[model samples]
Target: MFKSLLISALFVLSSQVIAATATNIAESAEQVSPLLPGLAVPNIELKDQYGKTVSLAERFKEKTTVLIVYRGGWCPYCSKQLANVQKIEKELADLGAQIIAVSPDSPEKLAESKITSPNYQLLSDDSLLLAQKLGLAFYLDDKTAKIYRNKLGVNFVSLEGEVKVALPVPAVFVIDTNGLVNFQYANPNYKVRLTEDLLLAAVKSVSEQ
Candidate 1:
């Protein structure tokens, strides 16, 4: 009977701690300005996998931009989503849209990632500035962050000694040449992703307009 009570008490304590941490993360996330339809997308400069500087506005100046924001390559779900996007690359191109995938990975890590699409641009958002501007950036709870660094080998710090592990919610945005967002999909659940069919429909609808 005593052992049972001790286990129950421990479980209750653990649950409370988890709840509090989740609440804090959610509260901090509330400050992010979520991108909505018709909002002008922010123009952010990012480094491509090839170590070249790229401007988001200039690269897709005349074409519809299909922007995909993901966590770094260390995330299996993110890698799978990116690969799925590549599988539909031709369809996206046929709709006159260019796909760009952004993540907090460094340029070196971005290049190492095998997720590739023809004419696809992989931009490094190591500073997470773009994610912050879009109101998609969120801080991982302390325990989760520690696990990522210690177990997952995802050190979200730069050589300059800046820690930047806070990440964007995996998101997708279809933006017209006018810099206005036409479609956006963002979920707090990192495991879920926008479907290819939905993305195609959105691109077609916006390109027609």
Candidate 2:
């Protein structure tokens, strides 16, 4: 009986702690304007996997920009997100929108990402300058960093591999033609993502605005 009681108590306490952490993360997320409106998308040049220098900000012209930042092609969650985004491409285009995915992976990896699901364009943020400017990026913890290096074979060093670049929290944004983000979703955990319905709603709202 005592052992059972102890186990129950521990479970309750762990549940409370997890809930508290989630609440705190959510509250902090709301408080921090890592994303701001009215500010134009960061003007940075990134090369596509095909080695063409592409200006990110320039791509937003004449349409709403749906910017999706993912950790890498290695993440299955990112793959699902891309698949969902692709599913809504026609609708998004009808709403005068385009989707661009930016990541800290190499051009080769971006190519692989395209091969996996070829709908939207992918940009290589190998230098991570754009992520730094956007403030949605973070480096992996030591444990995960090692996992990425050894197990995942994600060679950030080989790409532009000098200083460690933080991975971009998977984020989705609906930016209007004016370059203002009308809606945004971000989370550190890769499993979670913005639903297509929510994103479509955002696009519709932005279009109306």
Candidate 3:
């Protein structure tokens, strides 16, 4: 009888551990799931290029927002994307939309980006908090992190001094004045990006709606 009771207790403890592990995995997966259309944008505060605190939700309240999330200033692809977006900045303004780009680079680095445009806003997400809330954050494996640090000299240290190798999937989200995402595009492949035509179309659709 004593042996049976001990076995039963151990089984219950093991089951609880398994359940906890599953729950953790689920949460992690959810964090990486891209935010979809019709979802309310997360109202996270981030620092603008000048290091001023800015609320994303407040920006949405001002006008339709064309939000872009990129890897960092060090990434050439991100530079190209920013340049492409700059080409359409005038048209976006004509449609009454505001462009806001977020990246893991520090505020100082944002100013140094090759594709900096006066027409749009650049915000820093060095802590990756905003990306995580938007379901666009992903951790770099140890091997990749080592390559990025040693070979590329890309440090993942935040402004607050935390070191973590994480990056946001490049994404574009069009949020209306109501703070609702009318369209979103996210791709895990760093090389691929949404075309300017598609982005303009998405912004136009949101403006029309």
TM-scores of the candidates are 0.80, 0.76, 0.79
Number of backbone-clashing residue pairs for each candidate, in the order shown: 1, 2, 0
Q: In candidate 1, what are the lDDT values of residues 5-118, reduced to their tens digit? A: 999999999887665433111224445557899998778889988889988888668699999999888888998988888888999898999989998888998888775665
Candidate 2 deviant stretches above 4 angstroms: 1-33, 114-119, 155-165
Backbone clashes (count) for model 2: 2
lDDT of 1: 0.80
> In model 3, where do residues sit more than 4 Å from their true spots?
1-31, 114-118, 151-164
Per-candidate Cα lDDT values, in order, are 0.80, 0.71, 0.80
- TM-score leaderboard ranking: 1, 3, 2
- Per-residue CA lDDT of model 2 for 1-209, tens digit only, reads 99999999999998876654331111122232346655666678998888889887677766788998887787788888887888889888888788888887788777765443333689888765676566665555557677788766653421222333246667888877666768878776668899898998888988886
Give candidate 1's error at residue 52 in angstroms.
0.9
Candidate 3: worst-modelled 10 consecutive residues by lDDT: 21-30
